[model samples]
Target: MAELPLSGLLVLDFSQFLAGPSCALRLADLGADVVKVERPQGGDLCRQLYVADLALDGDSALFHTINRNKRSVAADLKDPADLEAVKRLVARADVMIHNFRPGVMERLGLGFDAVAALNPRLVYGAVSGYGDEGPWRDKPGQDLLVQSLSGFVWLSGNADQGPTPAGVSVTDILTGAHLAQGILAALVRRGVTGRGGRVDVSLMESALDMQFEQLTTFLNTDRAQPRRSAVAHANVHIAAPYGVYQTADGYLALAMTPVDRLAELLDCAALEPFRDRSTWFIERDAIKAVIADHLMTRPTADWLAVLEAAGVWAAEVMTWPRLVEHDAFKALDVTQLIESAGGGTLLTTRCPIRIDGRILTSPRGAPRLGADTAAMLEEPMLDGNARVGE
Candidate 1:
């Protein structure tokens, strides 16, 4: 079959942090030629995110997930010579990606306007903390800050307790995803017009976009923020019998959305109270309490098996180890064994979608710091006229 969509595209990635590198990674996965440009001394900060004090001998897990299928070139952009070389690289590139603050690249004389002038076909991709320019533009915008600003962090944790931040770097991931989308769209437009355009993505914007429903609700209503639905937050709510129930075996979430199904699955006397949608809140609270009491009587596994068999969606709330080991996980190809430090294998979550039934990209290890610097930065100094060698 033909190579993945971006085969002939050349992406010069001047990004180290999550958002920028992730977009390059996505392009790499699609078979684009992605060359990561990093500083000579430490390279991308991400390489040290998980395991501090990292070296080429030990790439961090956080780095590997977003940097695979990319080649690295170490160059000190502050040096005039190296900066010129990057311009040369951009002149020949189909895409240039960066996550530096608004004017950083411009100060280095490597901004989109200059590079685009050099190569009309170059697609410039930029990711910012707040935006290129705004009241909050100069403020440091990390994933944590974006999460807190976007209301994502506010909804997390239980309703009663202070909101807990998501364990993962969701804002970075969301921004990266948006950057990839913008790049793809720009590529399509460039194909039609024979001129590439700038693709801008902001973490603040992406995070807010992600909270679409909540934002929309607040926009139209008087509520300042979305009230967390009690039934949805607690896997087991006192008012809804459909939430997860406990058993002597294990915990399994109850799939009792429909009133009839809830009644039948829970073996309750009736669900007339549920039919009155106006009071789902009141009814859900009471019903959840009853379900909780009933579930406490059995083992989790027993409850899960009974509920699942009865067509109520249910699964054991699995731990990381148990989840990967579960037969269902194996059947679904949701995990892959990747080579970690010491040549030992570590289980990593596979990408959510499968292409042609393939779960993970064929085990290309993360590039060591500036591993390709020698080959990349070496002078291949033929002028454009002579380089073509027609």
Candidate 2:
């Protein structure tokens, strides 16, 4: 087997919930030994932060999904002894990550400055809701709040509809990805400079970054707000034919196809007047209305076949069941069944990245709280001179 990129590295995950733990999970996938440090009382709050009241082995299924392949050590920062032990672990860690609001880590004496002092070569990563400063810094960095505050909610849904946040925790997931990217970059720099650096990411920043293309256009175009289409629009900035239209049986998503070509294929005479490509955006709703009514006359498969045969980009919009059951999804091999320490199995998606043409996978699931405390505490310090936990 090829060696994983992050082999031999140790990551101390001092984060709770999604953003921080997800980052640590990726590092663990790449072969880093990730140790999740949690509060002694209940460990990470996510253990009980149930998503739809579903859990495995007494921990939320969501927690297991994000925290797979990690060991846990219960520690109370308020307790001087436990704090000292965590500091020692930090001193030995190659990477340390946290998503606490500003001032919390500093209050616990585990801020970047203090941790960096203990381990000069440590790559310290921090994720905040807004940023370390500004009026929103102290506010809770939850996903939905960040999405609403960052104008992300306005980007989805129809023009007449109320603001719609994404179905998933997009801000948290994107923030985690950004945090992982920054940590990787810092690690590369450390290899060259022999010095570690601090990586800072925020949910607001990540949410904005996800809208770079649309935001760029919005920013440069006289500060115009996104105008979602009246029809089944997928993106606010995209022109007509860039949406899902309901067919006789299901839905068919159309991409950037020529309106004339669609008119020829679908036999919709109304779309013929939309020959001018520039008018596609200006008269999107009218063109989409014609397309929508025409598509509803036929089933999704018939539309897809005709559109695909004509060299037009289109596909049948699929639900989770259809997607998972399809041969295409099976060929991708993106799903994995991970087993917890208690032997409970979880069906979850695996990492999308491939290293040396191999999909990354690990059988281990999320650890039980404090499961590795004694073992990790017995390991020698970074200098290999003594056991710091003693």
Candidate 3:
């Protein structure tokens, strides 16, 4: 029943794809009034970015997932009238987010300096493939490309396997999270100084930050490339038993546990020689091979029962169907239902943050293209020098 943290702030989302829009989504989740400023022609290109060929209402499910609980106002930045309207909106916005290439927004006359001139308290956030003025600045800031360039693929999969990217858009999601963090920090600073600042994040930088543990180890060590375990590979830098192994029936994941304890627990004589802690990383592949072969003797449930009983960090690797059906997942109450444009409910995740022991839930779905354009333009203050939301 507590009021949301960002209740009165106005956020203008100018980006089309994942990173910038996702940051806006989080702000919207926290009760910020977020408005998507999109091109009138097609709205967000993500509206057509269908995943699993799924569409919700008129837009792709992917677009709906990131854009729910937000309003939309369409504009053509090149058109004088639309540009003026957007500038007015920017003048009233507390935060403005975009993922255009370094100089694109500058060319559009809506760059940070220009917007800052209109609203000194506006937090300007930008997302890119790489930092501005870098060779990669012009490269498309897509998730997969950033992951491939940031050495993230090398950290996953086995040494013998081909480079494998994560199934999800990990870089884009993390970059969005990083941008949100930077925006929040800037907002806090603005509360103190009465001035807003620019926050910049790149998918490549976020991808590197995600590997801080392994990257730091690589930097401090001999600087050799990390080698993934040939068997049950999970973490590139971790020792044996830190991976998912195939049981007789299904998969079981094991975290860091003492080899001698695991040997005694599983009654595997092969692991008796690996009791020395220092040799774990050096002999990880060999140890993982033995563990892999031994674990295949029992089903995942049997291993989980023994491991859980012994207080070992182990679990059955579950599929999405199994995970969603489990009581533990159900208890989290992670999903919410939003009413779509046509009066049907669309199931999506609720905001994960808990405030005052209450979860934030909203039934608002993504808006139609330019759904709020007239209303926004018709706001009485938009016609004058006065800030609209102020």
Candidate 3: count of backbone clashes, pairs at least 3 residues apart or interchain: 0
Q: Positional deviation of 346 in candidate 1, in angstroms? A: 5.2
Off by more than 4 A, model 2: 378-390
On lDDT, the leading prediction is 2
Cα TM-score of candidate 1: 0.87
Q: Which residue window of length 10 is worst by lDDT in model 3?
A: 381-390
Clashes of each: 22, 0, 0
Which of 1 and 3 is ahead in lDDT? 3
TM-scores for every predicted model: 0.87, 0.96, 0.96
Query: After TM-score superposition, what is the CA distance of residue 149 in candidate 2 from its true location, in Å?
Result: 0.5
The residue-by-residue lDDT of candidate 2 on 269-359, one tens digit each, is 8888899998999999999999999999989999888888888989999999999999999999998888899999999888888787878
Per-residue alpha-carbon lDDT of model 3 for 1-390, expressed as tens digits?
A: 445788778888999889999999998888788889898899999999999897888789889889988888888999988899889889988999999999999999999999999999999999989989778879998898988889988988888888899999998888899999999999999999999999999999999999999999999999998888899999887788899999999999999998889999999999999999998999998999999999999988888888899999998899999999999999999998876666767788888887777777788888888888887765643321111112
